[model samples]
Target chain A: MNKKITKQIKELVIARLEIMPNNMKVSIGSYGAFSKDDLKRHVEDEDEIGKKVVEVQMAFLRAIKEGKLYPQE
Target chain B: MPKRMLVTLPDHDITTYYLRAWGKKAVKYAEDHSIEVTSLDRDKANRKNVESYLSNLPFGMVFLNGHGDENTVQGYNNEPIIIAGKNESKLKSTITYAISCSSAMNLGDASIKAGAICYVGYAQDFMFTLDESNSTHPLEDKLAGLFLEHTNIFMSAIAKGSSVSEAYDKAKGSLRESIMVAESSGNRTILSWLLWDYYAFVAKGDISSRL
Candidate 1:
């Protein structure tokens, strides 16, 4: 994807992550460590943030398969 | 003619926001339009309910609005899948419309294998009404006019007994952004919304029933 598209994807992933119910247990290990104030001091690229989104999404998928996210239906 | 529907909502309002919202009016509205809707919450959708519903000749339309997991679909009663004896068989072509968040993803393949005609739901997370002022996310909106708007145009075909796919396509076309499911890459959870449409896919059935 282009740089701009990747940036938008990051924003979208963040929005999806924020809505996951507590049952989904979405945690951004490193991203979580980033402080709001620190965000202003550092320049992060879309590709950098994009990695976290994939990790979180995979975590949720694995959680689902393992019966953590949404148990059997 | 009134079609019977086992309409279910969530036991808790948060996880099943779509159920909670649809219950607030969809049940009543469907009834007013002569749809024979049987409403239930998660607690009441027990074993008997699921078994009975599944065993019968398929209801023309199956409307589910609740929280779902890999092992069970939380209805007014909690119903888990029962493994029949090896030789026993199940249908693989029932049509379903799920307002549940992950019901489609968790149960999509299984439902199809078990004879579901078409399945619609959020592959990743929960679906929402247009709650524009939602405190939690910018995607939500106050969908006060949603049902009204949908019923007149989008849902008209379904109300007229058009097949599930027809109604679904009509509904989807009318609300592109609303039903799109964004496909996510196994990467960082960066701006993913633009990556996939929330209601992106429509798995169709073989040519048998017109609906």
Candidate 2:
């Protein structure tokens, strides 16, 4: 809900997404499509939908922070 | 009599695009094995056509490729084709597989309770990375293939008469191998989403049930 908090989360998600090979396209089923660059723009924009995308990204980030969302093995 | 199969593949955007293209693998397998396949693609994948086909056909396996949630699976234009607690019975007596988002969380359970033999899908958001360079050609997208191919393999396994448990295991195993391959290759981004998808993949109901 906080714009500053949302911006910080967006940057974090983009940082993670940036590690992929540029050829990759990340898809969240039917929500929307994103190339790496598209992902950056989608997550950082001030639009209502962009805020929701930030929220979703934050959830993934929170899971990662909690550990075990992605196993090392 | 050869068994019948119902396939719904709607082409709308990136996610649906991959599904529509990869679904042909299952369709081809069914045809080669003499399984009667009823395809509902594009606009034909709407609610009315889906309901009509299921109600009129004696299909044994149903594969749906679209977007969905815990309680519903959408078709062309995101129209709800199967809404939990409303028409899950349409899947009665059939083995169902949905390569959608989160329908397995609730719709899968509801359908089984409504009498489906088995339901296979992801419980949470189904994530996959596509190769934009392969936009005009989805099946060749290696990144997307890493995710979608497993589902196709599952469908093919079922078409070849493997039990639901066997097919599910085969798909999950493939996903696990892909994850390892991606990780070893220094690909950090996709591996996490793939692992998430692997964890989300689940099959409910008669595990021994075969199509």
DockQ of each: 0.07, 0.46
Task: Encode model 2's per-residue lDDT on A1-73: one tens digit a residue.
Answer: 5565445566777787677678777787677767777766766665544554455556655666887554443
Write candidate 2's Cα lDDT for B161-197 as tens digits.
Answer: 8999999989988897887678787886777677778
lDDT of each: 0.43, 0.82
Docking tier of model 1: it is: incorrect
Least accurate 10 contiguous residues by lDDT in model 1 chain B: B82-91
Predicted chain B of candidate 2, TM-score versus the true chain B: 0.97
> Candidate 1, residue B51: CA error in Å?
2.0
* RMSD in order of candidates: 10.9, 3.0
- Writing each residue's lDDT as its tens digit, candidate 1 over B103-169 gives 5564765666666666655464332223324424311332322222332232355555666656656
Docking class of 2: acceptable
